[model samples]
Every structure is written in structure tokens, then in C-alpha cells.
Target: MKIHFSARTIAFALTSCLFIGACSDVLNSSKSEQLMTNPTEVNITSIDDLNALFDKYQYNDASWDKGNREVPRITFAGVDERWAEGSKSLPVEIKKMIFFRLMTPLALVSNENILREREIVKNSPLDAEKLKKIALKYDILENKTGNLDESMRTALLDRVDILPPSLALAQAAEESGWATSRFAQEGNAFFGQWDFSGNGMKPLNQREELGDYRVARFDSPLASVEAYMLNINSNSSYLKLRVLRSKLRAKDKAVTGIKLAGTLDNYSERGQDYIDGLRAMIRYNKLEQMDQAYLSDNKLIHLTTEK
Candidate 1:
């Protein structure tokens, strides 16, 4: 079954809009709040039903239709638990296709939110108050000053930019095992983020030295993607990656996934070996082409499961 609701009919004002299925609640900006006021909802009971919906929307899972890279605005609030078991019956190629297609919209939408925030950061000089809020939001610990100086602006810009979709997709695939891992299936944790707050899922083989840290959990897949991007942008360990991206921007070069993937040596314990795996995934899947992809300017499509 399917349902559609115009923004006007939703009983809430535009000021409170959240773009729920695509935009992350934790990462919402003014521009992000303005999108997808109207949404279409589809209910599915299995992977086949989900694929049928994709077909109906003309969402091609095959290489973005040979480089025509406009992705349909099909977002899933969360994955149906059935997919994990049902997908095992499918071939590897088909499984990869389904996972990529399911995840691409979340990555694209998260990037869109960051780009909007980046625009605000770019014009930070005009509003010191807004600049301070942004700096705090992105965890700029160096800037304790009330003033929004050029240096602060530069730092915020370095940390507020969009991540390449290829890198995000590759990491999600590797970390969550294509959303079949216990963390992803139970908690929507795609990137294996650790939380020391004692409100997360504990791993079966957690090291005692790491304390009581557990993998961070999220309400939705989009939220997981949002948190992952925020971690990459603001975490101290990924500073080198941010610096490399800024250097690429300074040269007016494309900040590609392959280029930034080189600096992710600190992201995993395997260091260079983990970096090699991510690079291989990006190249093998031709995910670099996804960097140019954007969401179609159509009504948002939310995929849910039948009750």
C-alpha cells in the first residue's frame, strides 16, 4: 500500500519541518528543514516488494544509468528486518546492488545537509552569533573566543564540508557488512562508532582496556550516516583527512574519495590495510562516479515495512 501527504495537510507549520526520512534530526539546518515537505510512503513486506517499488519509481540500480547520475529521492526510515534473512537467498551481485541502492540516498541526503551547513560557514563573518553556534556544533574546541575571526571561519570551513559519497558508502559496506551485522540490524549503527556513555550495544569481544565503551546506536539509517559524517568531519583522529580535503579545495581540485581515503589510516586498527580495503571497494564498485550524483527534486519517497 502507498500513501501521500502534502506539507499543507500535515497539520504542522514549515518551521518545524524535519525532512524525516532523508534528513537527520541531529544534523538539521535551515536549508535541510526546507526540503521534502511533501512525502510519499510505501509499505513493503520483503526485499522483492522493495525492489518492485524501486522499479516503479524508475530508480536504476545499475551504474546510475551509465552516468546519468540523478538518484531518485527514495529513502528508508529504517531497514525491514526481513531483508537480512531474505537477502541470503540472492546472489552476491544482486545483494550488492540492493545494498548500494538502499544506502545511496541516505549518503546523498547527509551530504546535502553538510553542504548547506558549509554555505553558512562560508558566510560566517556576517553573523558572529551564528558562527559561534556553528563552531560549537561542529566541536571546534580551539575557538573559545566570543569573536568570529578569520581563523575560526577557516577552521569551521575545514570541518563543515561535504564528504565524498564513495568513501561513505565504502566504509558503511565494510563496517556493517552491508547492513547485515548485529549492530546495523539491531541499532542502525552502520559505521561501528563507539560510545562510552553506557547507552550502546556491547560487542561480543570488547577489549577490557577500552573500558565500557559500546558501539553507538541510532534511530534510523539516515541518522547513522549523519553521525558518521559528523565524526569524520570533527573527530581529532581524522584531522589529517580534513586538512587534505582543504588542500584539495585550495587547489580547486575535486576532493575525491580515493584522495581522502589515503588519510584514513587512523580510522581503523588495521591502519594501512583497512585503508587499502576501502580504496579497493571504491574502485571495484565504481563508487567514485557517485560523487557527482544528486537527489531528484521530486517528492520524498519513504520506504517502510507492512505491519
Candidate 2:
């Protein structure tokens, strides 16, 4: 999965159509106007500092609505360096906070793309050029017939589906044990994603019946988050979740994580119990409030460093 181009180049290509300026202007304006503050960098030197930061950004104010204000983002540098030495609580809290901050931006980006595509589908005729663009963007077959059928519509919707922050947080917590699991600590595999290519960390107790699958390794936690979102958006297993999200969007309703949890029975071996646990985690921790969270105008980048 080596990307040939730099991140800046990819980002510029993605935004050039939406912005009204040269590449440098687009880059500078995004940083200066959209970003209200410098990126907050958190070096996890001690548990006390981490806890204090979480308390500072706690979303407990009843007046705060998902539609009203932007959610702030925080970055953690050298996140994997000190996790093994700390108490379980320290790593768990750190992982939870990281998940909260990371998923907000990803969801916001996905929702924005979904809205743009919906408008395109609603307003424009499905010309050859438009269909080709859609196919290229979503990895669909461009050689197909030009008709915009239900299958094409469903494909577009599924690719643009957004994952709920609460659902993502709960799964991360359950799969990685608050980022203390061996895969997460060693390979940045926050979701326990499996790679059958033998390029990841092997589970010590993987049963023989499960086939030869290793926990996917990532260069950083942010990479893991991106992969997780892509999995939900594009994988066939999560089509039910995408369908549920589409219905909610059609009704102009919010996509709550709890409602979407029922569709994720395929995500794990626990079946109904997994969904119940996710909903329970959401309710017990009041994670529903984060469903409406949006990234602040300020940008935050999570960076990883070598030990």
C-alpha cells in the first residue's frame, strides 16, 4: 500500500475542484482561514497530563448541540512509546480520547463527500462524463452501460457512507482493549483488522478454523482510523449499515450510532451481544453526544515518531 505521491499533492488534487484559487492559495487559505489555532500536539509523558487534557475538552455542556458548534481536535505524538509501561486505565483513557478526536474529522469529510454526491445525483443528468467521474471516484466499473440504475446508485451510496463516531469508538475499545491489546500496542491495529497477506502481527491464540489471518499493521493510529472508515464505507459486509444510513439521510434525520449498531451484527463473532455491548458502551459513556461533533476550523495532524 505504498502511495506514490506525497500527501500534499493528493490533498491538493482533492480540493482543487472545490476551491477557487491556485494550489498555494488553496493550501494557505485553508490553514489561515479555516484553521483558527495552531495544531495542538500532545506528548503523552504522563497519565496526569493526558487526564487533564481530556477533562479540558470534555463535551458535557448541555447547551452544546451537534449542529451548533465545531468540535476541536487534538493530536498525540509518540503515542505508542509509553503505553506499555502505564496502568491499564492510562492507556484505555488515552485510546478513548484519541478515538474521539480522530473519528470526528473522518466523519465530517465522508459526510461532506456524501452530500456533494447526492446533490450531483439529484440535480445533474447522468451524462457519460459524469458517470465516468463517479465511477472513477468510487472505484466502480466505468465500462458498464451508461444508464444510472439502482445498482449504480446503491454503489455510490455505499462508497460514501459515513461511520458513526460512537460506533467506531465502541468497536475500537472492544477490539483493542482500549489500545492495550498486543496488536494495537505493537502494530497500531486499533480495530483488530485482519490481513491475510502475512504482512501483519499474528494472533497468539488464533484458532485453526479462522484461517491464516494476521492483525493488520499500520504506520500510525491515524492510518488505522482511515483504513477502518474505508472498510465500513466500501466493504460488502457493512452494506446493511450503509442502507440504514441512507434511509436516515433521506428523512433528514440524524444518524445515531445506537440505531446503526443493530446492522453491525456481522462485525464480530459475538453477534447480537456485540451490538448490545456497543450500545451499552454508548449509553454508559454518553457517547451519543459525539455523533454530532464536527472538526473545528483549526486543523490537527496526528504524527508518529520512531522510538
Candidate 3:
């Protein structure tokens, strides 16, 4: 629950992308003009302030290269309510840019944590009991007492991997309306996950036949990203995606976002159309470039307050 961000080194760290100009050429050129903005270094009290900070750092596709895309380690402790309200008045392009910049680092950081867990699963001995605990945590373990076996290890490897940033970004945009949804603004629920439990925000238009289901909420945007990734990695609903990813890994093929996204037919009731929409968003925004991006090696900057 400790959402963190930093002010120190944030200005320079976020601007690091300005140095790398050799990334993918697949980036959308039509939106390139929206990337630049006058730099502003001030406390984030409004959506405009956050936009200025992103502008100052050049945190956009124009700065991210294909192989060498290193973004700053900037994170927000929480989304300011003002951002949700204020973004309504901003131009569509500016709002999109801010949404990308805000969500990108959170997704990368979540993926980084998952990758570390993956290493633990990958390197540990097959018989290690800790593997059972890990597998159980990821919802892949049914037997409580058994030596971890090859099959379990393979399953763990399959589920513990990192998700493509493009996929995550696309879903967040589609689900949360570019972080402008009430769930996103109030509950940090960026992925539109449902909760049957009582502890959730009831949807205004929820179908009565669906019971008292509400959107899952989180402590912060980063928490939302982490929960969404976990759901994709372990939920039975996304088994197809895990299978596809594992197949790509076995074949030694690069597991690009677009490729894995095809397996998400069950993600929404809209099925194939939902998948097509995600792909279109990814292509239109050139989100694939973000898959290659990484966090800088700077010291962690912890900002406790959004104000």
C-alpha cells in the first residue's frame, strides 16, 4: 500500500529519454507533434502541472528508441483527483500523452517485479518447497504438499513472466478511458476487473443479472497495474495467452505484444472485437515501442504526496 514517487532526480531522470534517438521507426508520425512541451518543475497540484512536468522531461514516443529506450524511474504515489477533473478541459492529444507517461513507468516497474519473481522460479531447484508457496501465490498450485516437479516449474515459468507494455497500455487506455474513468479516478481500478465481494464500487449501469458485482479497486495506479498483470499471468481466463507466450519462448521467438494480444479473446464479452480494438490502439499509438523501454538505473526517488 506504500505508493511511492520522488522529486529529487525526477527532473533529470525523466529527461534521460532525450538522449536516445535510435528506437523503432514504427512510431506514429502523425502524433509526433504532440510530444513536445515546455518544461515545468513544480509540485503536481493539477493535471496541467503534471502535463508540464511530462513535457519538460520529453516523456513521449519521440524520445523512446527501439532498443535503447530508457525512461526515468518516476512514479506517482497516487493519482490526484484534480488530474481526472482537469484533464477534461485539456486537448485530447495532451490528455493521451499524459496518460501514456503516467501509466508507462507503473507498468514497467510492475513487469520488473514480476521478472524478478520469474528468476526466482527459474533458478530454484525443482524440489524446493518455496516453489510450492510461489506457485500457490500465483494460483497454479493445487496440491499443498509435493516436491516441485518439471511440469509445475514449466507452469510457473509460463505464468511468472513479464507482460508486454504495449498490451498493458492498450488495455489501460481502453478500460479506464485514458485514466479518466470513475473507477480509475476514485478506486485506481484501471483494468475494469470485477469484484463480487462487498468491497468494491458498484457500477452505475451494472446488469442486475450479474449479481452485486463491482469493479475491483486498488491502493494506487501501480497496484492496479500489478493486479492486472497478475490476473493475466495466473487467471484461467488468460490461459490461452500464457500458452501463446510459452510457445513463443520455446521457439526462441521474440514475444511481442501484438502477437500475444491475439490470445485475449476471452478477456471481454466482446471477444474478437475487443482484441481487435486493443490491437488497433496499440498500432495507432505505436505502443509496441514501449515494450522495449526500461527504467533508468537511478536511485529510487520516493515521493509520498501528490500535492
Highest TM-score, which number? 1
Clashing pairs in 1: none
lDDT score of residue 234 within candidate 2: 69
* Each prediction's whole-model lDDT (CA): 0.75, 0.59, 0.70
What is the TM-score of each predicted model, taking all chains together?
A: 0.84, 0.68, 0.78
Off by over 4 Å in 1: 1-34, 45-52, 55-58, 61-63, 80-82, 141-145
Mind giving the per-residue lDDT tens digits that candidate 3 earns over 1-307? 0112343323323332111111111112223212212211234443344445444455544454424477655555445455555555555665576568767877887887787678779888876776677788798777777567788788789899999999999999999887768888778889999998889999999899989999999877777888899999989999999998988989998887899889999889999999999999999888898888887654333332222
1-307 per-residue lDDT for model 1 (tens digits): 1222332322121111112244335335644444565567766544455556666656664444656688776666554455566556555665677678778888998888888778778875645666677788788744656566677688788999899999999999999887778888778899999999999999999999979999999988888998999999999999999999999999999988999999999889999999999999999988998899888766677654434
Of the candidates numbered 1 and 3, which has the greater lDDT value?
Answer: 1
Ranking by lDDT: 1, 3, 2
> What is candidate 2's lDDT per residue for 169-258, written digit by digit as tens?
778778877655777767767788889998989888888897998989976555676577777776678888888888888899988889
Those runs of model 3 whose alpha carbons end farther than 4 Å from true positions after fitting are 1-42, 45-62, 65-68, 127-129, 143-146, 302-307
Question: Candidates 2 and 3: which is better by lDDT?
Answer: 3
The list of candidate 2 runs beyond 4 A from truth reads 1-69, 89-139, 142-154, 301-307
Model 1 collision count: 0
lDDT for 290 in candidate 3 is 85
